[model samples]
Target: MANVEFETLAALLEREGALPSDRALALLREATRTLSDVHAAAILHCDLSPATLLLSSDGRVLLAESALARRLGEARQPDTPATERIAAPLYYPPEAAQGLPLDARTDLFLLGATFYHAMTGAPPFDGEDPETRALQYIRHEVPPLEQRVPGTPVLLNVLMQKLLRRDPAERYQSAAELLEAVERTERMLQKRQEARRAPAAAGAAATDTPRHGKRPRARQSTAPAEAPAERPPTTRRAPAKAPLWQSKPLLYGGAAAALALATLIALLSRGGDSKPQATKPPEAPSTASAVAPANTPTATARKETPRPVVEPPKPKPKPKTSTAAPPREEDTPPKPQDPPEVTPRRWKAVQGAAAGTETYEEFLKRTKGIEVVDYEDYVVNWEYAGPYRDPACAEKCGPFDNEFPPEKPGEKPDWAPLPKGADAGRPWLFNFRNITQIAQVAADRAAIYLRTRVYSAIERDVQIWAGSDDSIKIWLNGQIVHSNRRDRAVRPDEDRKDVKLRQGWNDLMVKIGQGNGEWGFCLRFRTRDGEKVEELRADPAGK
Candidate 1:
């Protein structure tokens, strides 16, 4: 089967208009159930909005774009502004916008905001601009759903109000509790609809009853007297007082007698007798008498020897026997197996000891056969510094203010030659290197520095492609080449800069800042013509 493409709930709302209360509640229940699972795992979806809620054609609801998710107890970086940390400020709760510590209820508030928009076709918090909208989340109360979209279910409106509560304590404490309320509201709406249809159905049934009852009586009165004889004595007996006009046998006999009397009178009149002798009219039985005898034999026969009801024979149970052949193994049903769980790829630590220090001759030997030095090949080794933080610095911190600053690129820092210690700086080698996954630092709200040296055979212009989780600044040969202070998820090639790589080894330094959630950065070098650079070598430990 081909994979199905899903559209976001935001797109659905735009094309089809706001969802009805029942439909909205059903989708909310599905979304909340998924949130409950995430909460159980001690994770929080820091970003929740209509654009992040995926809707499939098959009616499946899924949460997407979870790069902003953080651990339950994780706190935002003290130095990082809350505005830079949130993916969607319109959906952020008061506590989140204030840069305070968050829990499961933080996500619940966002979930409510997203669904409130799903039902009302607009976010609960509104302002003329993004800044104003974010402020609304902190300072203003959300307007009631029913007030915005009249005729919305009262229970649904009340539920939404609770979800959008300004204080975490007022909102549902857990996703489980929210899911239960959503389900209850859904059931109540269904019952109300069923109740509405009940009376209409009953009225229709009432009108049909009398119209149907007259049919059987009409069929019985007009039927021929012999009609009952066709059935077995045990099945039927003719009616005793069928109308005389309705009985065929009685009507036929009466007509014949009237004709005979007419003919006799005509003969007597022709003889001219003053007083004609009374003619005997043919005899005709009464309607009851005619119908009674026809049915009397059947009634008497029914009482004398009623037809026997032959009951169908009951099926006999098969006797258990060891002589029966056993089923073949191939014919037996296979047991069902669960689908394998797919885990997201995470950075793994490189193994094996570092190759001590290599001479300048060794670096040449390593690059002798290598024609091209792509981004990955250029990232062989790096010296990582503290997962540092300064609340006042935020995204504005520079090399001059940090603990250790290299005078120039490619040159070893003064701290590098210091005696080995826990806090001492040293070169770290990577067997499997992705610049973005280089340092798997435990802290989220902090900054880190990575410096490496690259040897180029000759001068050439190259394009640098870089991406970062939040903020990043790059230096080539101790000269700043690129800087982006805004926070965002890492997407390779999000930033590009052109620079010259002079002959011999040159220093390259990168400083990345993390606001919250995931943290990382990626860098690669491509020739001006978009081709990979050749005859280059990476030297992390200056020889």
Candidate 2:
């Protein structure tokens, strides 16, 4: 492999201060599209920060550092201690800080924070200590982008807010969706840049004419005699409609234009036989005579509008009439249309769908199979028991590894299944909710046992994904396959374990111990490659 060097976006920002809106937008679009690709492959860029964005000497923007990337729907490993998985607080999501299970949306939050830093040259939630920063993100809303940097585009500001939403459900559900939003904001940013440039360009061109030493009268004298009036009629009519109550200048200005047009036409008719002399000084007809030339029969024919009659003399006007009334008429009509030249309508903020509550089933349907684990697609039945409790056990300390059919109430000596509800006066229960709430077992600091007989067509290695409140332990065909003794809220697919299933029927059992609040567990199976297990059947009765 070649050692190619590149500058981190963080360093680039440090050297350049803050990026221009257009530059920031281009970089954001590229980074978002790259993230969309990563998500397409069922991967999550858990660590998205300015430091992870690289700018090549060739000017291409890239997302680098895949070390923190994890498979879609995967969560922090239970076997790994919490201390080893500490994330940089600046870029990690609120869910990560709270120890909740993560998915593709988690990365979207980080991406938003990273870009916030890119635009303002500082993290949205900044602190010297990781704990303080994490607390800030978890408990507080990020200040608006405009508040941090005045005059930031509103569309971009709103986008940053949506991406950094405290609730994952409020954020864009997929990278593709977020990419669409970014492209829209980028286009608006481009329109604003072009709008600002248009007026400056027009002003610059106007200034250049003065430097060329050509008076306004010289420009009028040089115009072709038969030149067409390309000016639109609306441009001329717009000024006449303005009321004097709006401004005294507008009323006086309209009257002055009418007088200028009348004076210009009369001069051309009387001066038809006279030749222009640059050395002659103006007397009573100073404004008109200064501009009239050696006029021809063409000048005498059309006297209605001053434009046609005055244009016939292509080269005689001099600097003496440069500030005359005729030049003022040409400038009046354009004032109405000037505002439209720098149109800011294209920079209007784009509105997005408002956030609302959504069911898990609705989410699955809307997102299709991407990023989320659809437990209902793979497994539909689970036989469960208990709200079993052992006086010797505390919160996460339970009879997870003890022998089945405990000698006493909630008692277990070693690794085995506990007594089924049928033997404990609670009888067995069943549900197909994907996530069995185990609400029937209402007691806190209790345990629930879930079992199902899974039939596979052939012997193969497969994966079982499970989640539970408080703590959970799983057994595959009487062998302990996975166990996580941590107190936390449940999320689907929090733990994935690979196990061998026999050619026929196999017993799958689960022990979930609850501490407080919600009590539930969800389980599903798939091929080792994370595909649906098409030839599997679930029987709560072990048929």
Candidate 3:
């Protein structure tokens, strides 16, 4: 195995006792959703313990040994309490004992349990004896997360409750669902923190506008002083009574929302107008923004609180006049609206690209696959099965080749259009945000195809760096360029080869094969000394 350049998450947590909830929340939420995406590709991660969740030195999460994670539809050994495979038994569901099918929900339960353990300093159903813990798990008898950790966010606590539910039907159906809640909670927490920094004097301006013509205004303290010291830090965060996303109902989209945008727009206008009394009392305290927290708490760091700030008086309102005057620059209230942040782009490869599984012994003669002719762009498929989302193979095959029944003649087989899968004539488009299991259904054999692209670039010395789980064969401009057949894990640029290209559109085709484990390939252009060959353009679809 190649040396992984990070430590386990458990080590980080052990090193860092308590972290600021936001820092910890962002890391956990993002990582959990990534694992969900992996499962969406039909891989099962039996090891969801903290040790398998690795943290890079710079604080990013990287999954290790996913190649070893079990594939869905593969037969698993019968289960016994002692024979169960999860490294940490406490992070699993009762289905392990009940002999029920494990799906994405299983991982959802584990993710919630992992977060609960991190926050409360104990597993949700901890006990002195293994028997007691298992019994509690089977009975759905874990303590509510909020009771264990008094200051936890309401959304998180409720989410954890649903996640740890004993009945799988009651749990989140997918990581996508869990991730939606996570992102909403993260944003709510951030918005609450920002709300805390609003100066108290700003309330006076709001108070001046009467909801009813005769409503009395709240009196601002003439002699302002610092806030009291004994307050709990969490008090500034208002009760998250409503999911803010609900405020913009149009996003949900229905006949009910025909009035939502217009109604919300009016409410916002009124909120901007003279009705501070209605808005100020429920206004979450804003003094917390006095200063930034000491540092972003990491897994190994203690949780840090913001220092209190002294509130400055907001400028008193100017007298109303018939002759309007231009508003003073400082007189403008800072908008509660925050600027949206941009996320960095990550690598994307199309997931389903399997042609058909070919028996290793018969692949040379029996298999119907692609062979490059002029190499401008051409896609070939099995004559019997045609292009299909699921493949029909002759024997047991790897997960990458397990989507369909083995090939059969005169058997009008069941087939469906490949979802976001490539089509014949048009090179199967295989673009996605991460490495994915492209296609499946053969065994002890090879399913081979070529991904040919026409590129426009200056005539120069260039290189192709590729990484694949299976050995890869590459042809550059109709010449035999490079071939390597070895068992290796998929990574960026596991191998590189120098190639020559013409100034006009140049041609390249890659032939990929399947190995026992996960199978796919990563290919990109780079200069001889190693710069992304950004000047080249490629149309793999030949359109």
Candidate 4:
């Protein structure tokens, strides 16, 4: 018995749905050779399906040659063949289903069905139940390739049809014939690809100038005052003309336009916040970073490997460009995160340690000097603080944990553009990707101050699940909705809370307490019956 271990092609197809044409062709090529070798041994492989053929990521195929094959007598015949019909109904041949005599062509029919499924994402007999599927394979005709998969190559489609013919006499007589057909189609495909690339490469080289890096400096003529009298006559290259697009005047104009466009884009992407962006501010005692501006990333918690920044050439008339201004930072485009489904909302968070009503009290009395927090209408961006004192208001502060929905925001610096790439280093919650998970300096105990406006198209019951290290407190639309202080490892939906969401936007905030080990929280919204809140959208433009 030929036994080999590898991922099965059927499993691969199910995982990836369907494969590209080139990859599918390569798989079929290996299958052809493996089947041909098995048939040459004068043994009929009665069972052939994607699952029976082991495949590898690096493009190798092995057929499971077990009870599937029977030894042939003289005249190349099986005296008593296996009649168990073990192949999948999707790939089962008509003769095999009817318990009729089978031969090499039996493998071809099953192989065709496999290829059909690989390219079309559906089996030849795609009926739901086993009985309906088996009957379809026995009687249904394979649809034309165009009908099932529009762009399949006609030659490959033709080969598949010939292999799938119901009559054994009409199908390819042996595996060797099918192999030849695959080889021919591959060659034609190779030629077509080369033909397509030939003109495209030439055209791009001629028209598309390389814009990857800096251009070369201009070379100046250094002819001496006295030329060599006996120098051999050399062709004097007439002063090489600059490319039309590279003329000094035109280059200057283009440079200015590009610089202005970049500045405009940067401002637009950051939103219309004009707050000062200090590199670092005086440290303050608070949860989250006390003095860090909204634009500032937690330098103590994370750091990216720095690259040398190079300034671009300035237009000739413009003053020398600033070497200190960041060059590489602007090049990194912001990634678009898909909004969470269940927790019909999104949040922006600041980190804190040992978060509780005391932290909230200090944040309120020390900073805002207010009793209640209306976070929805909160107007200022507060500097992040650790699980300590509020820097702005000092230790002499009051708590507002009871104020479920604070009437407004607390002490905060100027509102800067929303944090970009703040969640760079850490992994976000699986379902709630919009909310970033920030690491805390203290391992076991930390808290985050988060705020967001959650809107729903209709009023419905929404389930909220949160996981924390030690304890957690959440405020929904200004009401303290959830409070859990038991210490435990963080996991998704470790603590579930169900609440009713009114139609339109609702405010939500949370303070997660950390005691030891990994500390962070995950929150999301789902329906009453564990369905996603599909009608939810956060901060949508114009509702």
C-alpha TM-score for every candidate: 0.37, 0.36, 0.37, 0.35
lDDT of 4 by residue, 1-543 (tens): 255448888899889988887788889999989889888887777667777879955568888765666654324335333454635657668777666666788878888778888888887765444544554456556776557888887877787888888778888888999899899999998999887879776887867765643433222234543555456555654767889898999999999999867754443334324433322233112312333455355432232312224345656774457545666855966555633233211121211222344433344334331111122222122222334212232111112232212224684522212232224443333111132334423322234455556666578887886775446777787787988756454576788888988987777666655433334455567767876555354431212
Give the per-residue lDDT digits (tens) of candidate 1, residues 1-543. Answer: 157779898898989998887788888998898889888998888888888888776677888867778888775655565423567857768887777778898889888988888888888866545654665576557889989899888888899899889989999999999988998888898899897878787888889878688889988888979986788786555667878787989888989999767754553333322322322233222332344455676545544442355456779767766566888977976565532233111101010112446443454455432222432433534566655655544342222234434433375543222111121231121211123333343344466677777777689898887777667788898788888876565576788899999998888887777654445666677788876565555555543
Instruction: Kindly report the root-mean-square deviation of model 1 from the true structure over all alpha carbons.
Output: 30.4
| Higher-scoring candidate on TM-score, 2 or 3 | 3
lDDT of 3 by residue, 1-543 (tens): 255467876887788864546666887786776787788889877556566777765566766674336776566656654335345657657775455666777777777777777777767776544544554576454578778878877867777788788888988888888888788888887888778988888887889877674433333443234445556878898876666656656455654576655643443333322334434433312211111132223311322211123356779777677458878967977575632232112111101122444333343233213222111212222112222222333322222333223222354543322233242443333221121333334322354444445454368887877766555666676665987766444565778899877876665655554534344455666779986454344444433
Residue 177, candidate 4: C-alpha displacement in angstroms: 0.8
Give RMSD to native, each candidate.
30.4, 28.9, 35.3, 32.7
Per-residue error for 327 in candidate 4, Å, reads: 91
Task: Report the lDDT of model 2 for residue 308.
Answer: 62
- As a TM-score, model 4 comes out at 0.35
CA lDDT scores, all candidates in order: 0.67, 0.67, 0.55, 0.59
Candidate 1 worst ten-residue window by lDDT: 344-353
Model 4, residue 402: C-alpha shift (Å): 70
